[model samples]
Target: MLDVGSGTGALTRVLRAEAAGDVVAVDADPKLLDHVEGPTVVGDAFRLPFPEDTFDLVICQALLINLPEPVDALREFARVSRDGVAVIEPDNGSVTVDSTVGGESALAGQAREHYLAGVDTDVTLGSDAESILADAGLDSIEVTRYDHDRTISPPYDEADVESARRKASGDGLATDRETMLDGGLTADGYDSLRQRWRQMGRDVIEQMAERTYERTETVPFYVAVGQV
Candidate 1:
């Protein structure tokens, strides 16, 4: 199995335990490679280093959208795997929050726009795993949807808040000028944002904990598996 963009080897570790064959994990980040236990290589996904038809399966998670050229990357994945490829990515089209309590600040709005652009790709490709695999020439594709929820509470740390902020304030996605500080969400503004974010978080948690906001489409995870 070839695990492309295997960050921190999380998926790699899981696959290692589940699959009997050798697992070769690859990523561009050297720091992430350091934590991996088995065979690991630092390389680009667009241009994989291995020879053609080197593995029985190639698996990727949360990787396609990040690439500059997703189609090319898909073709590369096809080139390396002889038998099949399994891909798992967030269904960006399914991304939604019940409310924008803060009235969509520039940073936040931009975040949404950035996400929309990438999601457009997913939408164009059917916004599911089946489309991605089929488009990449994989056959007998199967897609599975999973509900993934993340709840944030008080004592909210900067890292957690920032990650959420970044996701909300997608890369150059927002058009508003005021919310964005010189084109980016600065470290300083994060604390103030956190206070506001915490209020929203607490509201949702309280409402949901009280069984008020039921079955809200806040987060969703999707998986697609198929043969090459």
Candidate 2:
């Protein structure tokens, strides 16, 4: 099996544990691949280094949406897979976020809207994977929907604390300022939103101090598989 775009080997570790044969992970960043335990290759998705029909299955998770040309990447994946190709990608448009903090969800939606608008790639392309595979000339396409639910509540961990701190500092939103601006959000509008976002973050911090803070986010992921 070939795992394309296997950053940090998260999925690679899982595949290695279950697969009957070898699992070779390939990524563009050697720094991320350095963490993987077994065979790893530094390569691009569109131009995989492997020869034709090298693996029984070629798969990627949360990768295609970031690419400028997903169809071309799928075609490349098909070139190396003797049997099939699969992609696990999320539908960002369908994501649901809830928080006990006042106005958090609304503010998050606004931020997401701007980010999506400015983002160059299709972040919500999970549902279109089937058709994309078909367009790439792959047959026997199949898709499965899965919901990834994340909840944060009592007994906050270090990571949760760090997230709250970043929010309170408005650092997270600040990072996306350029993207939001490019997405058509006016400077004044962004300032106003950032002010409110900081307030929401403060509220979140207060609630956390009382151990009452809670948040839930659900992202829908699609597992699209096709025969080469």
TM-scores for every candidate against the unseen true structure: 0.66, 0.98
Question: Candidate 1, residues 1-228: lDDT per residue as tens digits?
Answer: 999999999999989999899999999998999999869998999889999999999988888766656767878998998998887777655566444334333334344443354332443232556766777788898888776665444444565455445434432223332444433556465445545544555544454445443322355666888887
Off by over 4 Å in 1: 98-126, 153-217
Top candidate by TM-score: 2
Clashes of each: 5, 0
Q: lDDT (0-100) at residue 103 of candidate 2?
A: 90
For each candidate, C-alpha RMSD in Å?
6.7, 0.7
Q: Which digits, one per residue and each the tens of the lDDT, describe model 2 over residues 74-174?
A: 99999999999999999998888989987998899999999899999999999898898999999999999999999999999998988898888899899
